[model samples]
Target chain A: MTPRRSERSGPTMHDVARSAGVSQATVSLVLNDVEGSRVSAETRARVLAAVAQLGYRVNSAAKSLREGHSRLLGFIGDNVASTPFAGEIIEGAQDRAWADGHLMLIVNTGGDRDLEERGIDSLLSRQVDGIVYAAMYHRRLKVPAALREVPTVVLNAETEDGSLPAVVPDEYAGGRAATRHLIDHGHERIAFININTLESGLPAVVERERGFVDAIEDAGLKLDRTLVKRGDGDAETAYRHAARLLDRKRRPTAIFCANDRTAWGAYQAAADLGLRIPDDVSVIGFDNQTLIAAHLRPGLTTMALPFAEMGRRGVARLLAGGSGAGVDAVECPLVERGSVGDR
Target chain B: MTPRRSERSGPTMHDVARSAGVSQATVSLVLNDVEGSRVSAETRARVLAAVAQLGYRVNSAAKSLREGHSRLLGFIGDNVASTPFAGEIIEGAQDRAWADGHLMLIVNTGGDRDLEERGIDSLLSRQVDGIVYAAMYHRRLKVPAALREVPTVVLNAETEDGSLPAVVPDEYAGGRAATRHLIDHGHERIAFININTLESGLPAVVERERGFVDAIEDAGLKLDRTLVKRGDGDAETAYRHAARLLDRKRRPTAIFCANDRTAWGAYQAAADLGLRIPDDVSVIGFDNQTLIAAHLRPGLTTMALPFAEMGRRGVARLLAGGSGAGVDAVECPLVERGSVGDR
Candidate 1:
């Protein structure tokens, strides 16, 4: 094949300037909103008309917008493939970015720090307007050093310094709401089944526990240390924990699980003890993981993490000139189902 | 703010040409791999050094490779958030694309037609090298008109007309493999539970069923029509279907479920009937949905859908200049667990 440039090449900025009888600098200023430009309205109109007539588009190899924006956002995640909520978060970001006529370049780090740094460098190389660093779970993390080179936001996780705007689920509220729901049902002896705090290093566990403590204290109920059991937040672990608790002489009439999996274990424990859900022991859970919560015999009443809303707000803030690196929390709505009942 | 180019602007082709003492066209030919260029090896070496010295990295908005390529691949999906394998597919594509020095622009359409069209348009406007049209499930679909404009490969789904390369799970092999696993466990009479065939319009149903039939016939076991049942592929439906089969005097020793959820339903049915899992009836399932399969009391043995492998192969095919519109099937490995027992 002959090495030749196509005759009908895409129109460049220079072509627009030439057709408009103006300098390329004038065209760039009027079109790209360069602050304090001296170009007149008539000349701007002529340049715009010429650009329209020529169907000019900034080529990927030589694009130089005066505002220095690429209209591209980088969504960097850790091990997104195996993470259940990764899709929801990406869906949220992609929908919003596309709505604003922008594109997203997604990079899943597979939880490697080197890979994450490389992802950030790649995003920078592409001149993305901003970057969103996200985690599969809600936890504290060390922000990647490369994030310092660009406007960055963290999602579903937080940085130690709180120097970047973050959008995280209100896990504390979710826990408090779960406990309160059981309390409202006239259950004075409500047990709390939680994931082990120190072992997990997950904010969800620490905040949820705090919320449980606060709610019980605020409700004028003395917190029962013996009734609070910690496990690995799995069905088998929860089953063992609940079994031991229910075997006690003064078993709680209601149970609030840190997560739906724990509630599932509680359900099994109750069944093994010849107890009926809600009828004999009311139950509530957090993070209304639909697969487990909805599939349980008596659909679990749990808290719905505001995953999509967090992504939406993150982008909205970035577009609204966000800075100052403050932490933000989104509401976790109570998803009432059939589990909790009156004592 | 003087409406002038930045002093530290990236060096352009002109700079490289000037440094190499050659025309800009010659530099472009040598660097971009334009075919049939008669440039000397020494001149090409000089241009390469100049390019390295200038640090001329291509920007996202104006990236241009030889043959008008942009080094950007579009990964367009429908309703990826709710899908179980979204992360696996994306991780495969992203890791593969990045390994080849290409970046993927992902667009999730939430199953909306207009949004899908807009996504295609957006990708085309950015001059993406090619597109990977992905679906959340394995089914036949109407190829978007915009797909006609670009080189495309469907992932996890097929177009009505085989006009594009597709990488899909071998559901037939998976089903046969599941049934064969039960047979291998010394079960002569095995029941097949599945999703509705015609109602679902999913190729998975038909293909998987075909494989089940083939395996049974190959085993010289008469295909028992009474042993085959179609349900909604939910626990409730599977429970109902399972109850009828268990009620029979000549019940099958094993059951092959369409999915892990169906296997869960079978477990419930066995429990309700006071039957021990491996002692009374062994069960095997399809689609190793970790949450359900691994969590089930006796982990449900199932076939793993090759989601990541399919995505990897799809990108590999596109990179290999795929356009034959051939459908490639990825192997679904049988994951052995405790669900199946020796009869």
Candidate 2:
């Protein structure tokens, strides 16, 4: 537990104080810039000059002890820091934290309960000002008991007990927006390619489906039950469903894919069947993952999840002392590209 | 500068010591399990029982002060923590650090020089045991002056001065491997879609191209300059180049794409030309980005960048006192899928 010197051996505060001809206490007060201190401006200047000359940097550990806060926020997520879409959540939170003069201490647990517990302990031991507990996808989870002792906000997820503040994408609104966009394009017969809830009971699946039905009914269009198909939210499954739907005797003029990956499969189905996009069939997608949506032959028009916004909001909530014990649904904006056209 | 109480008050160390009928110092030694401490087993048991009953957590700041080292590794990267491929580097470094009883303190700079300087200052001030300076891609960079004060290892990058230890992908070896895979498939007439160094003078571009030429010549095939085309390392540009090659009178039976995104474009071109993958024309790609590679109709056969491995190696070097200097070229293993077939 002994203090080890850095390899390069930078000048210490004591050396700076000695050079400035001031007591170490005066140097500490001048360097920390403590408010309402009785030190004269000349003394402060002398200490500052000595610090610059000696290249003396404040020891953050000692500073943290004196301030009682580390000016650091802990961000713990389950498989969010490394994944494609979820990584944006970390970026959003980090940017927001940095803007507030706080740096994020990130720990990605990849959904290991043991690691998650250890990560929480590590963050708590480090005395992070607050914690942002996040999930890769929108879902309900039970947070660890240790988090109750710290100011905590959940991102892209909600506490099962609903005792903590949370921010998640407005899946219902996103679904409504996607359907309404297709309707505005003059498409009456719109088929829905939904994520299979049986395989993954995600809240997004049920909420988005509800929004789709509500939009169709609101538009005075007859909702055909047979027009809706459920897939495993993957390309191969969506391809088979799209191929069948497009080949039907009474084919829908448009298809609303649950996600970008699903839309990718639909694109291939239309391509293989010699059906031109927007001209022969209009398609819309959700989760505008730029990697796929932007690069498709004709760019895909899809709904963009507010991952970054959710992250920012989560950190903001923590900074505000983790107030408001309820789930806050952020709006998902529609990103229009080359995929949609007049039906 | 005063210590602020957490929202939910937790039992402090003093409270545990009081309940255990022991001095605070005895509790500290028992809890920290300091090596060769003179605490009897009975006293340790009593202290642990009190800790469990009171739910007391150690103050990490105080522990860090006692131990000289924070037991934390600082990871400062230029847009690596939130990107697709680069995020893996963080994961690799984090996993390795955790295995050695260290947690990574990650800071993503997004290539802002000011932020990079501030991030390094923050890490140094916090007294991180070491640092991992990383770049989003393989390239050479000048590290900050502050980095000299600590043990630093560059990940997926190298220092301009070559004074710090670094780990980057073996771009030349990857390129050679990609070409050899195609040649092994009995491809005589092969073409290469290379990254345009005019737009991005990345190390991968030059090294990979060299490896491609070397592999072709080593296989006793006639090197054709006309077969090599350059693009912006994107799907659209690669699409145009691939379409032209496919339409030529003496088209190549196989093509090697510099990256997966470029290969995705080539896939579309071949499909549009009614050429089935691996059946009619073969294709290979570099940087096996699973988001594209695994989801493509037929999985892509490509070279996988050793991003995660580089991260692990970088952290390992830092843990080993950052002893080695010069660059360590990690091998990019070939991931064989359904893309390549016999010509």
Residue A292 in candidate 2, Cα distance off native in Å: 0.2
Best by lDDT: 2
lDDT of 1 by residue, A102-193 (tens): 78999988999888778787787777777778888898888977677667789998898888899999988888888888888898898898
Top TM-score hit:
2
- Give the chain A TM-score for each candidate: 0.83, 0.94
Per residue, candidate 2 scores C-alpha lDDT tens digits across A118-217 of: 9998888888888999888888889999888788899888888999999999999999999999999999999999977634757789888988999999
Q: Please list the C-alpha lDDT of all candidates, in the order they appear.
A: 0.82, 0.87
Minimum summed lDDT over a 10-residue window in model 1 chain B is located at B1-10
Off by over 4 Å in 1: A1-67, B1-67
Model 2: CA > 4 A from native: A1-9, A198-200, B1-3, B6-9, B198-200
